[model samples]
Every structure is written in structure tokens, then in C-alpha cells.
Target: MRLYWVILCLVYSGSAVSDQKVYRWKDKNGNWVYSDVPKKGSEKVKLSTNMLTMPATDTSILTPNPATPTVTYQAKITAPSDQQTLRENSGSVYVNGLVTPRFANGFQVQLFLNGKATGPKQTTASFALRDVPRGEHKLQMKVFNDKGMLVAQSAVTTFFLHRASLLNR
Candidate 1:
């Protein structure tokens, strides 16, 4: 038993002493050099054995709560169905739109005629436009949140307008 214990201690001590030693010195080029081999002007360097450790992160805070679900908005133009023709002698047009599940407060709707904004943003989806020239035009609607961020957009609706011409009278 004593011989076995002595052999075990010797093995552990030999392993501990086998650690490589580091030496630091300046090379011929005047640059610092570090290596395990000793040189004539090299000095032994003592390195700290303490290791750096980091605490485990709590992933629960990074994950979103499951209770509140995200909402996606959908919008469509309800009036002036695509490719529809209208007869408006006074050059007036009425546009209407719908948003799925309704939008929250502070959200506004904007009308686009021929790819151009026709009027200021309004809370309702309805719009009354006047002096619309007679011809084909495209209309679209967009919904914006309180911060002016676009939430939803309707597909382009194409329509034609006709008005009485004095030459035809």
C-alpha cells in the first residue's frame, strides 16, 4: 500500500513539473520575442494561473412573451372596382377602402391617384376628389400608423372617367 501511494504521488508531481516555461527577450531586430526555449539574454516570464470565467446568461429575458400575438394588417379598395368605368359630368370621384379587422387609433389612410398622393392623410378610408380629368386613371390606398410608418397598402384599382364635352352637345 505504501509503495502504491508513493508511485501515485510521484506521477502527479512529475506531471505538475512538466508545464512549459516561457522566456521573453529582445531579438536582433530590437523587437520583443517570446518562446519556450531559453536564450543568452532571455528572462523567465511568470504567467497567472487564474482563468477568466463568465456567468451563464438567462435566455428567458431574450425570448418574447407568448401571450401577446403580432397583428398583420390587410387593406383593399372597396369602391371603383378594378377596370370600372364611371360617368361624372362634374369630374368628381368618390373612393372608399377597407382594412381587415379594423386599424387602431392614430392610424390614417392616404389616397394615391395615378401613383401620386391626391390629398392629405385622413383617419377614414373614404375620399372625395374633384376636377378629375376624363380618361383612365389608377387609384390605390395606403394605411399608415401613428409614426407615419406604412402598415398596409391596397392593390392598384384602375377606372375610367367620362364627362360631357361641349363639342358633343
Candidate 2:
């Protein structure tokens, strides 16, 4: 029994040690090097042969539901974080907010500026505060589903940025 146990332990240890992964690639000058650390000028890497490849399976399990029911959420800037009032010569002002129902790959987000629909309505979206006459202004965001229907609207939040006009005070 003692001899059998020793052999089993050695076999397991050998397998584990052999499973370390290494990267492979050829350098820019067309010489090949196989070091665990990526060489200085290599652009692509091939993984080691000992790495396990998962057996191919039906792909449906990897797909997202197309008819997945849409979800909606309301985001607010919350109290002191919201109110900002600024000046006229500041060129363009930047307004920002955290968007909601973070999509798996952020594939269904949209943004609006000053009540005007801006852009083609994109996912992973952020909007710039632009072309306001200054003094005081409001910022808002609208997030939507892939189907173009309004799914969520952010609370109409306010903020301020001062150009030289207001800063001289």
C-alpha cells in the first residue's frame, strides 16, 4: 500500500507540472523563440500544446435570448451632485451620468442632450453637453432597448461649469 501511494502521488505531481501553459510566437525578424515571457517585438502568440481544448457543444447555450423581455431603470444624479451652473465663454460643457441596466456587453444604451435626440443612439453610450447659452442648464439621458422603444429615462439633472465670465467673481 505504501509503494502504491507513492506512485500515485508522483503521477499526479508530474501531470500538474506538465500542465503549465506557455506562449509561442515568431519575432519581427522571422526568428522563432519559445519563452514563457513574451519577447520584445512579438505581435501574436500561440498557446502551448498542453492547454486543454473544450469539446465542441451545441452553440445555443452560448447565445443570448433575442426575445428576452426588456428591463427599465431610472437613474438620478442625487442632491448636491446634480446642480451645477456655469458661464457663457466656456465653449462646450461636459455633462455626465451613470447609465443603468448595464448590458452584458453594453449593447443597448442611448443618450440625449438638452431635449434633442443626438447621435444614432448607441450602446455603451455617453453624451457631451454642448451649445447651451450658459448661466443654468439641465442634463438628461434616455436608455433604450435594441428595439428603439424607450426603456428608461434618467432624472433630469442639473450642473454648472464657469467660463472666465463667472470665474472673475
Candidate 3:
């Protein structure tokens, strides 16, 4: 009987020491946050309240699941033409009116210089090229949904800027 009691104590003690991991991070607003270690900056948090057990009743019944959000389409991209040609070291280049889908919520245009991504710009259906360096500049336009996911990618547009003529110099 004494041996049986000792065995039960050993089993209970073994189960009591289980550990769980969590992570911590700060948001753009500078608030501290915590999540599992797989999350960014999770190493700073000490584990707390690992073995809590709750009655298995439906707590979610009080709160309804949010309806799957629907995304509305907007203009796609590349109006007049998907491609353009320009001169090297030429001042600002213009990429005129790209088409947007009829039902689009908004448009995001990403510009690439040469082959590198410059950045993204938000507009209705048009984008202007500014301060393009001299040489072959490749411009690409991608359209996105209101949720900021790409819906369409326009054909790569190539433009060239010719060296200024001596006559002009």
C-alpha cells in the first residue's frame, strides 16, 4: 500500500512540471505583445501559466464568427499601353493612363527601374515616371485588391532616354 502511494506521487509530480513557450514583440504603435517562440522577438518572455485547465464547454457560442470578408475588384493596370520607351538620364518620364478593372476598389502601381523595384504608388489607373536615370529603364505595374494582394501584373514596359544632342547642348 505504501509503494502504491509513492508511485502515484511520482506520476503527479512528473506531470506538474510541463512547460509552454510564448513570444513577445512590439507593434508599430510601440505596444508590447506576446506570442509563441515562432513569433518575432519571442525570446524575451518568461513562460507563465502553463498548466491551466478549463472546463471544455463552448465559450465561442456567445461570439459569432466573422463573415468571410468579400473583396471588391478595381481597375487592373496598364492603360494606354503596358510598355514605354525613354532616353537615358532624361528628367522625369511619364507612364500614361493604365486601365483599371471596372469594379476595382483602388489601384497600387509598383515601379521598377532597370530591373530593381523602386516602390509602390497608390492611384486610380495612372502613374507618372519621375527622375528616371539615363539607360534602359524597365517599368512594371502590378494591381492589387483593397486587402493589398496582387490581382494582376501588367506586361513589362521598356522605355529609353536618348543622350541629349550636341545641338541642344
Residues forming the 10-long window of minimal summed lDDT in candidate 3: 73-82
Most TM-score-accurate candidate? 1
**Least accurate 10 contiguous residues by lDDT in model 1:** 12-21
Clashing residue pairs in all predictions, respectively, total 0, 3, 27
**lDDT of each residue in 1-169, candidate 2, tens digit only:** 9999999998888787666555567767977777666656654454454746799889997889899986666644433246756554745765455655564444455555556665666664455545656455566667665566666777776666556654567
Models 1 onward score TM values of 0.61, 0.44, 0.43
Residue 47's lDDT within candidate 3 is 50
What lDDT does the true structure give each of the candidates?
0.93, 0.61, 0.60
Q: Whose lDDT is greatest here?
A: 1
Pick by TM-score: 1 or 2, better one: 1
Off by over 4 Å in 2: 1-70, 76-80, 86-88, 104-107, 165-169
Residue pairs with backbone atoms closer than 3 Å in model 1 (clashes): none
Off by over 4 Å in 1: 1-67
Off by over 4 Å in 3: 1-90, 165-169
